[model samples]
Target: MARNIYITSIEGHAGKSTVALGLLYTLSREAKRVGVFRPVARTSNERDYVLEMLLAHDAVDLSYDKAVGVGYDDVHADPEAALSRIIERFKAVEAQCDVVVIVGSDYTDVGSPTELSFNARVAANLGAPVLLVLGGQSGAGVNRTPEDLVQVYTIAHQELDAAHAHLVGVIVNRSDPDHLPQIIEAVSATAGADTPVWAIPEDPFLIAPSLASLLDAVDGELLKGDSELLLREALGVVVAGMTMENVLTRLIEGSVVVVAGDRSDVLLATLMAHASETFPSLAGIILNGGFELVPQIERLIDGLDLSLPVIRTSFGTYDTARIITQTRGRLAADSPRKFDTALALFEQHVDSEVLLQRLDLNPPLVVTPLMFEYGLLDRARQQPQHIVLPEGGDDRILRASSTLLRRGVARLTILGDEGEVRGRAAELGLDISGATILSPFNEELRERFATEYVRLRAHKGMTMEHARDTVTDVSYFGTMMVHLGLADGMVSGAAHTTAHTIRPSFEIIKTKPEVSIVSSVFLMCLEDRVLVYGDCAVNPDPDAAQLADIAISSAATAAQFGIEQRIAMLSYSTGSSGSGADVDKVRAATALVVERRPDLAVDGPIQYDAAVDAAVGKSKMPDSEVAGRATVFIFPDLNTGNNTYKAVQRSAGAIAIGPVLQGLRKPINDLSRGALVQDIVNTVAITAIQAQGVAADSAAAASLAASTTTAAAAGEQS
Candidate 1:
């Protein structure tokens, strides 16, 4: 991959952060060691919000001290010295990263029309490609025609050419969606087919300032309500002056309501509307006019459990409204909703993958957690399997579903009441319209599932009536969907126990013919590389055969994800160092793995340190190939495996992803009840990849059987 790229805008307020965020996320998927830098920037009083937002991503391992260089004033005072300093700082970041994203200055220093050229020169010096971003919102507002955008592109291209910077792509962000086709046609013809060109429509939600920005703009204080709601975006401003009936009717979703402090009628009505959910959900309430809350109003607001962000400003209603209208939105590290929306919009509009191909982002040198996670998503997306989420009631699931749908990662079927799921998603301002919402109560589906359940469990004395009721359980219904080919895989357990999520799989999906019992593994993502730990979530204490099976499956799982598997059977002893029943069990398991899969490289009766540490391995089992550098570790029991994985996860600061159930005839994985949205996304991606692997296995088996049949026919004819 091109290790460095510089993103610069043609003018101020060009939505460059939207373009930078998209490229950063795209680079994150392409490489694990991604870096973001700002060569020249305006140092804020508190912090750099854009750099902070980029650093907040897990894939970006950079500190503010390293990501930024001299200030705009410094660049203005001494251009040569400032460029040198910028190069020095950029090199420091580049030395540590495989690929870097260099975002241009914020253009906060007004009256300096040379800022764009300065940024281009910096990119040329750094040998980075330039991605020029144009402010389509300004153009669209002025009713600029398609030729206007093409003219903007021509000028930007000329500036970059003057600086000797390679132009890789062009993006017209904040453009009108209705005018995208004409703009793209004109720009693409000018940009040339070799250079990619895309247009991102202006999203009102993205451009709307957050409640935090509004509060700052009006110099306000929180009089009551949740402080967290300050992060919500204020899509519109409602200056309440009319009667309560008129004001309440005018209230809009995500709008900040500003009224005089004495307007208890409006306040009470807004509170009632918030409680009823029949009206629009507001961002918060802003009260001005310097009037203190009356005793009755204070008592009334205090009596309620309020969540609306209520702010008090010294300015009157009109002044507050004026200030709020002028406040533009910002992309801050704390605003996840904005980042999500920005990424979704960018992915929807930008052809970043094609641009990367032109830049030649080859495979990374080493496998990292970020790289592995991206691999799972990439594989799943290649085929786009239909994965089912059983826990539709969990907010995290729904949010992750929106992300998945937006990214086009997988086709999802959420098991729940259609109305309830739709209502919840709308209330949360989430767009999950792309997902398939299925309810367990659907009569036709329930009976078909119930009949299948009976066919699978008839020997267990399962009756039609009982099966019908049992299949109505979401977990069972979802698993049945996979079993009947309605879905490719299943991801659940955000609201249920591991057994509750996987029990239906055991009864219906069962294990592969070569496998006796199902097992699970945790892909421990360390800073540098990814390793596999097995039997950590399932099988409390597997005997020798089961342990061997876990080892074999864990290795295969690791290999399936592009991790090389040199097996290390962990124990309390290393070779002949000690003797005990536990060591002996591990030794026997090692022998079993060798007996079954001689193709695998394995070593057992080895201490944890020896299994991982090169020095310890040399001192203990110098002749063993798997004594050190083993990518997959098989734990003999759950007590040791679970505690060890958790300790490493917390102490070493690793990301533990899974309880990825293996050996299943079909793919079914479980999630921790405390799983975050990104965690759910990763798990679902893993489940989809596992589904791809299963299909491949079935296809291979069918091909082998057909060849055998043809050979038999040939022999009989002869």
Candidate 2:
């Protein structure tokens, strides 16, 4: 029989969907093939989102018709018959996979007195291990203390025992950040040594409903605004009951404003405020009472391009607000934010090895995009470092900071005025509590940074007065922090040029002892494998030796990220098939690599097709080991490297991450000017990993120097 992970929750809105998604993700990482099954579904006409998300994963191959069993009505009608049918259906799914993840029925209807028992019974009959989930949201009258969590776990454990079901794990979702440690300790003390427990702090963004869900809840019609804005989440709802001035004061980021359709003044003011940089961005606008925008007001705003959603609903403002508040966030496939947040939270808190050890799974074979992303975040979190984002004025930075803090990926210091940064995040309804907001104008830091800067640049005629003023820039201030050992790494370029971001680093940190120049590589994540493309972001036109150094550095970088190293010296031709100065330079670079690093697998003057395609590689260079499976590609120049990476990224549907800089004394990365929030997150994770590598190298160098001194002292004594 295949191993099964049964995820069950006793109450509604316990955030089990996220847990189920998380478990499926963890299992898919190592399991050869996985299956998802829902023994019972909601009584409503809509499909099960949790099951759909699981089946949508690249790891699963089952269909909806085959994955779902009976419904709640059938269970209520005949429990025995329903259980029998569920088992029969579940076995069919199990027959085709190495393991299966069974999502227990949701507690939608509160009337079922024996719902928890039913879940336990189902798991026992199916011979599956249960991973019980408890809701830990604490607020107002719903105070679930550490002792309260224990009591709930005790009851759930009793249910599992009575049904003879094995309890292997417990998760406390939506936990209070302040009491997370207490909750985990209390639960673990009672959950027994055999069962591991994890707790994820409640994230406001994860719990907030996207505008799409709110639109559906109110039966809204898109009146105007961008369709993509529907994906923006609504943190809360505001009823425009009063005048425009009063509503403006009540405005907050991700708020859905509900007003009567005839409130032209309110509508116009809200639209104007959203466009202004000083005001908070709304999730959407709902015009209730079955009214549409009037002709005069419509004409006034028709020429203006709005960025938020404006929906029209027939219900009154009061009714719309009520419906919007009850709408919950779904772990849908299209909802990338929720998906990433859930996976990050799970990987950070849960010990997947314990669960995998119980399953006896095999090692992973293929490197999918999702798998690569998960690995990056996991490795970065293992030794979390302090990374500073210099462009704190950007909204994307604030959003990314929230995600980083919530995921516990790294300690962050955002460089900006504390009041401005805090106020901006508040207007946007983001919780960036964990990040330390530092101002570039701090007197002590400014003086210290200025002194160091003048000292480092004294040969270049740098003045103390000039240095003091220069250190007030965010990029300079942040880089100085890294140089002073306050932060492990720095990531910039969201609001500045590449030169502006890295100029301070170049002046202060400089290159490593062995490296002559700093170059970069983009981790090209293909469908099933990841490739490295170097010199794509830095070095305009490198010489033969520089190209060889890039290949060597690229190889080391690939190792850092767990990618194989089969270097391909990309050129116009394969081997000696074509001759030119360009091809000759590649050949020379290839020879240099072979002479320096004889252990590394490398091939020269190879075309792109020959480097990647098995048949082409075999035909071009039959004797070469690196031709068919080259994971690292060294481009001759920036022109070719930049265009080629972009082409492959678009054509192959690959996720191009980073221009991750190599050969630096410390880890400093740059981002594109138009980077997204996810792009920022990926770059930060890469920066953290680079910091870890830098630390290891420094430690090794220090140990070697100390040993050499000791040896000399011993020789003198002899």
* Each model's lDDT: 0.86, 0.87
Q: What is the lDDT of residue 274 in candidate 2?
A: 76
Model 1 TM-score, all chains together: 0.88
Each model's total of backbone clashes: 2, 0
Tell me the deviation in Å of residue 605 in model 1: 4.2
Tens-place lDDT digits, model 1, residues 1-718:
3378889987887888888888887888778788989898675576767788888888888888899988977887899999999999889999988789888988786623378889999999999999888888662356346798888888888888899999988888888778999988999999888888888888887778988888898999988877766777888888899999999889887788998899999888887786565887777899998789999888998888766779999997778888999888887776666777888788778776787886788876666677677677767778888999988888899889987887778999998988778666654556688999998889999999999999999899999999999999999999999999999999999999999999999999999999987999999999778999998998999999899999999999998887889999999888877888898999999999999999999998888899888988988999999887888999989999999999999999989999899999999999999999989999999998898888888899999999999999999999
Per residue, candidate 2 scores C-alpha lDDT tens digits across 326-436 of 787777887665776887778767788887887666666677776787678778888999999998899899889987887778999999988778766755546687899
Q: List the residue pairs that clash in candidate 2.
A: none
- Each model's TM-score? 0.88, 0.78
The C-alpha RMSD in Å for every predicted model, in order, reads: 3.7, 5.5
